[model samples]
Target: MPYPIVAAVVATMVLLGIYLSTAAPDLTFWDATELMAAAHTMGIPHPPGTPLWVLVGKLASMLFSSAAPPRAITLLSVWSAALTGGAAAYMAARWLGARGAVVAAVSAGTMLTVWNNATETEVYALSLLVSVLLLVTGEFAGRPDTDDHERRRARALMAFVCGLAVPLHLTVLVALPAAVAFAWRGPRPVWREVVAWVALAALGLSAIAVLPLFSAQNPTLDSGNPESWRALVSVLRREQYAVAGLWPRQAPLWLQLGNVFQWSDWQVAYGLHPFPTAHPVRTALTVLWAWLAVLGLRRLWRHDPRVGRAMLLLVLSASLGVALWLNMRAGPTFGVGLLPKGTPHEARERDYFFVLAFWGWGLLAGAGLSAIASALGRRLPAPVAMLPLALVVVPLLANRAVADRSREPVASLPRTYARLLLDAVPRRGVLFAGGDNDSFPLWYLQQVEDYRPDVTVITVPLLGAQWYRERLAAQQLLEVAAVARWPGQGAVLRSLVIHAEGARRAVRVSTLLERSDRLQLDPGGGWALQGLVYAPDRQLGAGQTGLDLPALRRQRSMVPMGALAPLPPGADPAAQTAQELLQCTQVLGPADSLLVSGCGGV
Candidate 1:
């Protein structure tokens, strides 16, 4: 077989093997659960709906009928990432030969964020694949050997994929300029061809309509309930996250830039933080890595200036360009300096936003590595010469501890927490919960796993949305009374507890909600500490103020939070939970009492 074919196959097998070995075997936290829930049920998700992914994920679920819905749906990300790595390697080999292909495959495949996103059900992996495919198609189409007919067909496909990316994931747009600039370089298409391309593009754009059509059926997890044309427009525009302008940055531009560097530092060295958070050794390694990337760009410029310029546009537009556009809150500027705990205001690390940037670097790094290996080969014995090439294994070995999802119990831990909390609640109880880690997992278990459907789980912060309020009202879970928005959700939550009590339905609260001081769930408010959840206190207004259940408390250990990364301002939750809960609490079967499925009824 030709080198490109060999490269594609080898890269696919290597990356796919690595990904599956480390892949999340079941459900996950954050948007993973929500996205899986939406796709599995053919319902709506958060703003923009991700209709393209939902459709493709649904198809994967159907094809893999033997597997559980969560795992089957998650395969879309896993396979797409492997395919992306293969495609990337193929492109590198086509230009830079076999040595470059090996380096490219390793660099792209083992990127911390890329690897993490691939191991679970998420949009980024598939989105990256689509965008890369578009880039690859455009590059091949513009080749000198390519005929006019082939070029025209390729352009049409590129146009369609570009339009399709809108409903898939908007991050793909970061790649727009480079992909289009090259593909459209030929003689301008006449009005007739232009009209045809536009029509094809419009067809791809039409996929966004899937949201409204699906929402009209009233699916179980409709986020925006975008059944009408107006509602669809709101979701497509992402009204939740959109801002009028880029002024008044979320974090100081300087600090945010530092954050980008810090996260990039972690990409190669995960979980093994050197002393004092920002070790000199790490800074040295990061500088070396940046130099290699620059060297790779130099190689590209020398080898193929035309392609180099396009890929350069890709790197800048993807990395620095995206960072500027995000104006996002500060992340943990770990290596930057000693700043206040709250000084870095980002909720979660924003490294994933620059996925393409890192991916682009992988190609450059491959070129750089190949050049080094060649130089070493000319100066040393064959065995000694290949030593430098072993750096390809560095990422897998170094990043394994943190990026290996198979080892990370974050997936089952949330389900375990949900199991204990739901089991503790009475039948038909209304359970109020907290953030993505707390609430989304419960929804995944209840809706996707078909566990604890008898209990209703409401995310407190979402109560601020009128759509959510109306949805709950329609289900008779809550009434559309005057509401207090999130951060001050206390009043509305208190009213909910009282209303549920009046109806004689048991009301419970998740401890996760305690993260917000403005929300009240206390023994004084008739809530008794029951295991990981707070249950309605029957003895409210009586002499006893606090109540606890020993039987329920025993199950608390089952909730493992070992997957959470350490953030500043306090001791790490993972460490704290391990010491306080995992050490003393009664243990159970599997992984030395680190609950896999859950406490029970999973």
Candidate 2:
């Protein structure tokens, strides 16, 4: 096949793969939470991290229902990746010739990292797409013979695109050095034109920052008070500090530097341990891309001495620096010490590999493809020349198949749990959970069933004293006495106990499981109490007493079973009920205790 025809086919396959993969499932973490929150309110809040994406998601949801919004937004992400890939292909073809374009197109289209993000709601893919476009435009305008006016126009457009990407994700700012270099290589423009272009770019980018400012002015955009703006600013500053290696007591600089490449290994072994099969293709591609990157750098240094050498060096330094910064901010080495243990943030430090690997793979593959084509010209028949194309095409098809299987459409726990909780709870009561996990449940239930004003689902972590002081100011949840045990001895009548058996054993489960009771069976085949419970007269420790069978029978308003006999199957007389009472609550003896409950002002 002709090189252009081959590139077109490959690009089309990539786009189809991205669309199908994204359509298959909702794999992105925190996506539901951010979208739901945005749907209910106007301005962006803390946590969900990407304000721009959230705003866009909210708009999408408004146009369509929440159920359909995610898929629609995912489609947009797919298109963005395809467009970026095409731009990379064009740049390669223009710079290195037809063979280079074919290599670049295949490499970018088949890249696992880009494909992974294309099927999710994360902002990285969008940022990367914009970055590639800027680079391509810059490269095109940098030709020595390009007229000054044309160069000025091209530089201005590049600046504008970079500026638009800034608010979408602050990390895109890392590409500024490359952008500046691109512009400097071109013919000098009049000072006035440079100033004018800079201002236009700033204005376009500043459009994103304006949302927060507008929110500050209109407090009604969110539920919080005016002071919430200050909190938002503080959080943004902290994030910037963390990302820039300015966070205090961070890991040593050397370890942070090494973390970028090693991060993928850590993520697979530790982050997603039990689910090792989740992203096999992505893992393999990451390693392959890294190897090719090193090889590509060597080749650039040897043959393509000027522009290629500079590009290789710049990519390496920038990638290393960015990787170090992300590692410190994420603090993955501390294991589960951070808040929201096992969240995507803790695992995503490895995401930098996507961009780094794609560039490396493209450049190296371009060089290799060019060489092979040259060698085949004299020895191989024309028909056999298509074999090299097949080599690139097959892996891409396999990659797409793997990507499709790895994603699950209804895979989100938050959406499932939220729906379940909403159904279980009473219409006029509150349901409390441990952390930000509660946010999604609350937002979804309220939006889906209109349960907000009547039924509230409170998250304990967000209600803590420190959280209130920082985000809520003096208006904080009212804390009652810190009762030590459970069914709490207090007079609070109604409570829904949700015991997440799976979560209790994990590291850093305390914030969520701290005040809950733990029940277990003894080795001797009797019930065993594992935690304490509060009572009116005393703090009942575990295994302190047997269950009050007669009292429980009376509570049930029925006859009691005699002695310690087990309840007979299908003999459901109230007489057999008392024996099963102990099993219901998992009480070992009369003195066993239960969990407690209370509420606070906010």
Candidate 3:
């Protein structure tokens, strides 16, 4: 086998082994559930729908049999990550020989961000794989070893791949300037070459059509519903989530630096348990790694200035560029922002966005270590000199235990929540679920596992949008106009109440709105809740109050009062059940105590 092919196979085996040993057995929180569900049902996911991923996931699903849909989707991540590790190893081997390959393998394989994504059903693994491919293809295309014909073909191929990668995950745009800069250094393409590249790129970008194609079938969780050209353009452009108002206000320069500092720490030590606890030791290691990265860049520049400059650009663009963009707050939208008071929020962790930076640093570190080994080889016996390379085991050992999720039952909580919500609502009921955690799993359970086909779940945040309203209208027997009038939670809640009362159907709100103050929940008013609201005619007693646990206890499908916890602090409003549960003095057992203690800001 060829050197690059061998290196790729070795890296793939190593990464796949680790990932399989640690893969999430079932659904994960937030995007994992949604992505898996979307893939299983051939539905479009959140803004800028990943049609390429959906197609790949569907293919993976058919080839791999699993207990559930998420398992199959997670396998896709494993394969992508393994391929990424393989590509990273191949790049190092191609650039710096056998020793460099070893160093790079350790650097990329042990990265926390890569390992984290490898365990779930997210798109980052594929993003990482494509990134490595883009860098490798671009690097190899301009190399002296390649003939003119091959170089031209490689550049065009890189262009096409770049185009495909961008629409798949917009973050892949970080590679654009670097790819272009490297391309300029090579032979200028003639008109035909340019057109060929452009045409191929156009072909690659046509993957967006997958959304409209699948959407026409109306799958269970058709996010964005890109059935028409206008809707297709809107989703592909990410217009819904692209609002400037959704971004948080920019932070002070120092805080932004701190943000970078924290992100740097996470690159290697995120999954390790005791690694973070030993702050002084951990900080020293991180600083040392940064220093090594700098040294490696310097060494690379001395060896090959073009490659060194390319590596530098990759690091800067991926880290600093991404930091500047992410840190800029877009104010507020609907009085809620992604991360209200800046990053480090539990809901949205931004560290994953810089996987490219982590990859760059890993490559640099490998080069630096390889340089050191070369120096040692000149002074000492080869065997004696190779001993220092054993240090690569440090990160591997430290991150292994925490990253190993083979036994972890991550799906339990979401699965339980989905079952509880489904059971709480009556047959063919309309369930007004609160947020991502509250709603996405329901989609997964319903669409993938075939948990409950009758219950209709309307996500609260989507209620404010016309697309979502239209989607709900098409799926359910509800009037979009009346629902759209109230906007926010009020609109959805009122419609559910009216539907329950008039249509003789069941309608249950996951929890009452936090701005319960603005919208009246009185019996005669637009809103009302009694106990769990299991039935249409189950009117609340005078002053019975919102989300009564005692009443919920008596329901046919009982609320697990002992398992409830207070909603964590977020920019979004708190649900009534979660809000009231925080103040509940009743402790059924140790479970409730543990659950209560888990709630922050209680």
TM-score list, all predictions: 0.87, 0.66, 0.85
Query: Which candidate should be chosen as best, given TM-score against the real structure?
Result: 1
Write candidate 3's Cα lDDT for 290-378 as tens digits: 87788778887887677788889998998888767666432222112424554333334456788888878877876777778778999
The CA lDDT at 84 in model 3 is: 83
Show model 3 residue runs off by greater than 4 Å. Answer: 181-184, 245-249, 271-278, 326-346, 409-411, 475-477, 482-489, 511-602
Q: Write the residue-wise lDDT of candidate 1 on 1-602 in tens digits.
A: 88987888888988898888877778666688888888888888888899999999899989877987878978888899999988888877867686678677777678777888888888999999988888888776666667888888898888788789779998877877777655655666778888888999899999998888898888889887888787788888877655435778776778767777776776665555622256566566556666777877787777767667878899888877887888887664342445555564555567889888878876677667777776788988977876766777766776666666565344455455556667767788988776676677677778878888988888876776767777776766555564323434556666666667777787766655543321354325344445455555557642122335464456554545452333222222332342332332233322433221211111
What's the residue-level lDDT of 121 in candidate 1? 88
Highest lDDT against the true fold, candidate:
1
Displacement of residue 490 (Cα, Å) in model 3 is 2.6
Error of 3 at 273 (Å): 5.6
Instruction: Find the 10 residues in a row with the least total lDDT in model 1.
Output: 593-602
Compose the digit string of candidate 2's lDDT tens values, residues 1-602.
Answer: 55544554555456656556544244233444444445445555443234566566556556545445445556556666776666666556544456556565656555555555666555666677777767766665765667777888888887787667645666565555655554566546779877887897887566555455545654322322223566455544544223444565255556555445444332212222222233565456445555544654455455434446546645654567565555453434433453364543342335444464444455555455554554565798956764554445433554554334223222343343344334333344444444444455456446534554454444443442233322322212222222222223121111212111122211111112233321111111211122111111113343232233433333223222222244222121221222332223333344333212211000
Q: Whole-model Cα lDDT per candidate?
A: 0.70, 0.46, 0.66
Sorted on TM-score, best first, the list reads: 1, 3, 2
